[model samples]
Target: MCEANAYLIEGDDKNLIMEAVDTIEPDGDNLLICNIFGEQKVVKASIHSLSLVDHKIYLKG
Candidate 1:
């Protein structure tokens, strides 16, 4: 319930990367995201902003 969905901003569009994201770790220049379902993704992007109220995680590549 405390998890958030992750998105990658691409110009005028926002792409959903992962849902129910439970953990995020800094992996060098990239980011490592892990969902509650144990799904993992390594994205070459940076943290753009976080909307806690909206339950959203925004990343900029």
Candidate 2:
């Protein structure tokens, strides 16, 4: 279904911030997101890198 999950990294801890994300867009030190159910969310953080492998979104710092 091409559904993606968003995760936020905190030191040595990782947290699942959002799920069923339709897409992700970076804006400065934040992220603009559109969810599967047609919901929008904004996260304030610094994005290190973005990759898609096997239809999964990996946010790494």
TM-score of each: 0.95, 0.67
Local distance difference test, candidate 2: 0.70
All models: lDDT? 0.96, 0.70
List runs of model 2 lying over 4 Å from the truth.
49-61
**Lowest-sum lDDT 10-residue window in model 1:** 44-53
Enumerate residue pairs that collide in model 2.
none
- The alpha-carbon lDDT assigned to residue 45 of candidate 1 equals 97
For 20-50, candidate 2 gives per-residue lDDT tens digits of 8787788777788788898887788655544
- Per-residue lDDT tens digits for candidate 1, residues 1-61, read 9999999999999999999999999899999999999999999999899998899999999
Residue 42 Cα positional deviation in candidate 2, in Å, after optimal superposition: 0.8
- Candidate 2 contains a number of clashing pairs equal to 0
Candidate 1, residue 23: Cα displacement in angstroms equals 1.0
